[model samples]
Target: MLGSAILERRLELEVSQEKLAEMASVHRNYVGKVERGEQNLTIETLVRFAVTFKCKPSELLAEAGL
Candidate 1:
């Protein structure tokens, strides 16, 4: 599976998957699956992630190619 730009950005900022999950209120494994392009994300979940990154959901979608 292709790695997500979310993963790229997270790594760029030196944030751990667990930490991101904590901040996003998501399961860590869900973040891992998302990073690995294995998750079919809901809008709410995407919003949680976008909020964690302090970015717009559309921007995150563009980055993630959703």
Candidate 2:
């Protein structure tokens, strides 16, 4: 659910996985895995994504209906 929200935000922002990874300071492959819901994420990673997306982590979670 969070992964899907992340993907949606990425698409809405017109960024590729590689770009989002760079912005979030994660590996491109990791971003792909995340979008596919194939990996677990740390809270730190979630914060990083929120920073990269210019939103709050809670907002992201809310968007994901978590």
Candidate 3:
């Protein structure tokens, strides 16, 4: 569910997974895994993604309806 929210935001921003990885300072493959719900994210990683999307971590969770 969280991964889906991230994927939706990434697509909405027209950003590629690779680009998001670069922006978030994560590996491209990690980003893929995240989007596929194959990986768990730490608070730091969650913050990185939220920063990349110009949102708050809570906002991401909210977007996921969590």
Highest-scoring model, TM-score = 2
The Cα error of candidate 3 at residue 28, in Å, is: 1.2
Model 2 Cα shift for residue 10 (angstroms): 0.3
Off by over 4 Å in 3: none
Q: What is the C-alpha RMSD of each candidate to the true structure, in Å?
A: 2.0, 0.6, 0.7
Which pairs, if any, clash in model 3? Answer: none
Candidate 1 per-residue lDDT over residues 1-66, each given as its tens digit: 223778876887688999988988988788899988888888898888878888898888787565
lDDT of 2 by residue, 2-58 (tens): 899999999999999999999999987999999999989999999999998899999
Ranking of candidates on lDDT, top first: 2, 3, 1
Report lDDT (CA) for all predictions: 0.80, 0.94, 0.92
Measured by C-alpha RMSD in angstroms, how accurate is candidate 3?
A: 0.7
Cα-based TM-score, every candidate: 0.86, 0.95, 0.94
Ranking by TM-score: 2, 3, 1
Deviation from native of the Cα of residue 15 in model 3, angstroms: 1.3
